[model samples]
Target: MSVSHETRDGVAIVTLQNPPVNGLGLATRRGLVEALAHALADASVEAIVVTGGARAFSGGADIRELNRPESGMEPTLPTVIAAFENSSKPVVAAIEGLALGGGLELALGMHHRVAGSRAQIGLPEVKLGLLPGAGGTQRLPRAVGLETAVNMIISGAPVAAGKLAQSRLFDRVVDTDVVQAAIEVAKEAAASGELHKVRDWTVEHPEAAVFLASARTAVAAASAHYPAPLRCLDAIEAAVNLPFDQGIETERAAFADLIQTPESKALRHAFFSERAAGKIADVGADVAVREVKQVGVVGAGTMGAGISMNFLNAGIPVTLLETSQDALDRGLATIRRNYEGSAKKGKLTAEQVEQRMGLLTPTLEYADLKHADLIVEAVFEEYSVKESVFSQLDAVARPGAILASNTSTLDVDRIAAFTGRPQDVLGLHFFSPANVMKLLEVVRGKATAKDVLATVMALSKKIGKTAVVSGVCDGFIGNRMIEQYSRQAGFLLDEGALPQQIDRAMEAFGFAMGPFRMGDLAGNDIGWAIRKRRYVEKPHMTYSKTADLLCELGRYGQKTGAGWYDYRPGDRTAHPSQLVNELIERHSTDIGLVRRAISDGEIVERLVYALVNEGAQLLQEDIASKASDIDIVYLAGYGFPVWRGGPMFYADTVGLDKVVAAMRRYGKGHEGAAWEPAPLLLQLAEAGRTFNP
Candidate 1:
């Protein structure tokens, strides 16, 4: 049983037995109801005290059970709460570690709640695109004041019980044992003979209407399109206007409808996919991991400096190596400037910044990295540049040191082959502005050791990164899929679509920036270099010449202050460039291509479906172990819309059959070979299956 019953003195103690933040599944709910019934029937029982161990009161509903039919079976969370409400004996909640989502709602139902001062409490269902489906929306405001409950429910962030010690939600917030404190509260409640039902509590506010109106504007402005924040406010407002029963009905109705929304499904998928990305298919937790006490970074440019910040912030010392004293000084200065910028914003203290900066050892010598545990090469993104760096590391690095290449496109296996210890060499492909970004693509090479992979994965989490493992391949996962997306964006530009039109469509569809604006920000020279290589390696492939023309004109992006769009110095805003648009028209004419009016729908489909098709192919090739892994990469690294999920999940929601039809329709146009659906995508569509399911 997930619920255990025992009697201390004349009080019946009910403990939630499910381990690791006792989730309220069907069995747990059933056990709770049965225990309440048992306590009510007992002749000597004076009061009932409910508790989940010291680690957690409850984390909430068993997320694994959320999709199951049994989740809504007979003894639902509401039914168990009803049992407590109907009970003659006083029911008290002993909250220890955390009470979140349904867990907080459960605590709210008890006649009295006794919590440890350090316990975390909140209703965080909004993060899953939900309002608390139980009675949280109604009771929270009545238990705590209106503003506090509204803030907690809407933000979905935890608050310490100690902070809420003055709130009525907890009868006593103590430093001592919470269960024992609850027993005493239970005895007091039993003697008082008062049914302290939250439903009877008044949700009072002097300026209710004005407060709700202001909140609506704030939430709407915060997320212009997301429905949850506003929907949550709607439910909370119901608690203020209507009775508890009506408010609960409103919350339940909102939850039911929200679960069916595409936004909610996408949010739920993202939540699960991120957690799943940490686990490698073959490498178990039992795998041995190397200690990474000291880190060595080659190259002292923007990337090397950012990479060094991640380790220094994690309290690991780093030896930042550059070719010259001048370059090393510049890199060190850049790191300090970033830290100072953070301090100016009050995100870091001056002393804290110095503590992080102190961990760094800037050097011009490769021999200085001999004793380091891991050496990450963040030098220039060229084979020869990496080859020289790795050769020096192979010669100078200790016997057990792990060597990593921060190569975004270059093959990890070939990079590993340059070193004598192939097992210790792998690609740690960190996105640009490495410390700021959450995604870390861990590329596994042909001969990379299992322990080496495990160690890097662990270290990635320690440094606050979502690590997704990728098999050795050109561009690994994100870059490979993005290449196709970029190609489609170019094709759109050639077919009478302006850079602004294409970028606006993508941005409207949830991408952080349109391909053109992104190119301008990331530097147009980067794509030109890739296209330059593609011209020799993939001569048969078709690509728009407009981008090449833009780069050739010395418009290398923000660095040059011009590319697809013009930029003014000291302002990051991109202004439409007539020079670039005229160039696009000339290129289309030079290619003898007729410009057709392209719909925003067509632009979005072409760009996004291109990514979906390539991702499916990667899944088929085993370059990616799972579809969810690919989704994680895009969601984390790329600014794929969270509301739409990743491209793969979005495809499933759109219906694969429809996606294939769209691709087939696009195939009739230029570069038809690239638009052909992957065999795996076609197979799944025919079988009526989904990529993530």
Candidate 2:
């Protein structure tokens, strides 16, 4: 790592050159200090401008070096910010691409910030289970005020230079070259010869203290198991209440404290794990992915319309095939309404909506899709319909044209085998409301060609979705885990815990929505449909008897105004129904099992252990590549909070031995239920090792 200083017409340029992200590691930090010394000592250099070569300004402090004992040499970011602040000349920042985490913190230190048109700025330390360690807490509050700062820091969202300028986060936004803009700003400042000091900028609306307090409460409520967001609030509060130096000290202390936490370590592990997810061991980067300029969709229901929208929204033309003109019209109307609603909500302009709408072409014939580079079948769950659709798609679509299915639970290999071109067939399992959900489980069939896998994975990213590759299995990664997790929730209900108690415990565990609440929102009938099919295959095995009973009574969740709880028409909030409680009591009594009072800890353990146990099974079977992949699936597709890391990461934090013990206890107490500890969980418990390691 090195930082070079160059002077031209009273403007000093400081370039941070650390390969890759240019993270503020030991060498980079020391080099930065030396560069600042050169700029500040020069008599002719009136202003200093800093920028990074290549794309990223910096990702963050080098994770590989952060906690290394030998690197006591790691220059704490606060010290470097102090140097930037005490400089005689106004410090300007010229950011090209991404300025994230500590990168954004360093930018906050400068007196003036100018970025290129596409430059994005964000403090994403929260994603790593941390807050900005440098004086970002103090300075950003001074720049964008309290509320905006809190939202950005908590959400870990980055915005373009234009938005940043509108929000006044930057002193100026430049469309031309950033380095040139910085030089001009420096020269203009030198001509004026005005004393420019960031510290002297008084914070307006001192009542921002109230805003900080409210934000703290919201953070605490949002982050129960995760410590970073709440810790971030403490630093922001210090900025509001304490002196600049004291606030800096407080921010450093809080940052140091969080870096040592297990939550942070797990989250940091997850961060690197996700980047590694796309890189398969056998597949090299040279694997040729077929170009997919146009796509074709079969079926015309909600799933097909949503699938078409995803392709169209990504600026890819889609040819939608249906059996009749009526079905095509219905599908087209749904697509139109979806885009029109988005336009009305300001997510898209009317003209932009029309442009996107024009990308869709509906046809009642399969021959029209002959030119499509990729074709996806999004028909009903019935294997016959899917098989027939794939057969037709194989005949019509050109050779080497990738064939895919949006089947959630169907066997991908079976679907692949239905068509003559098995190597070209794969499963692109998009979640319901495909265009909205972030996760798309790209199921690799036994005969799925490498090129086909590569193309779908790339396409998934192009459409703004995180795709996790999985082997052909019953439910892939997310649903496979959900099957066990939801089963445990149902078991808890039979064993004595109410839906409210289960939901509460899970919420406390950092899930955005619990199983019962999720069931209510998704309509419990979906599980009923799948469960009926599953029960047919496993006739002898014992399963939860209460869920079907609830459905039998016409409680199909929020849709019918009744399910786990009674709904008030359009309202989302849940209230327990006496009828459901009576049903639970009757079921418990019919089974001759005592419905004893269950503790909150028991509710949490049973539910979480069920999922963790399944994740272990997935790991053992190689359905999930790593322990963190399961976490990513849950974090993105499910409502698993990022701060707690994910279910598997949380399990490691809770300890494997404890999970094994709970599983054993629950299995013993609830006879005939599927609450057994997974073999991998038992093995790890015996060895006393964490899943993440």
Candidates in order, TM-scores: namely 0.96, 0.90
Which runs of model 2 end up more than 4 angstroms from their true locations? 1-12, 18-21, 34-48, 53-56, 63-65, 69-72, 83-91, 143-155, 159-172, 187-197, 206-230, 261-270, 568-575
On a 0 to 100 scale, what is the lDDT of residue 13 in model 1? 96
lDDT of 2 by residue, 219-295 (tens): 88977778989888888777777888888789889988999998898788777767767777677889999999999
Residue 283, candidate 1: Cα error in Å is 1.5
Query: Candidate 1: which stretches are off by over 4 Å?
Result: none
- Among these predicted structures, which one has the highest lDDT? 1
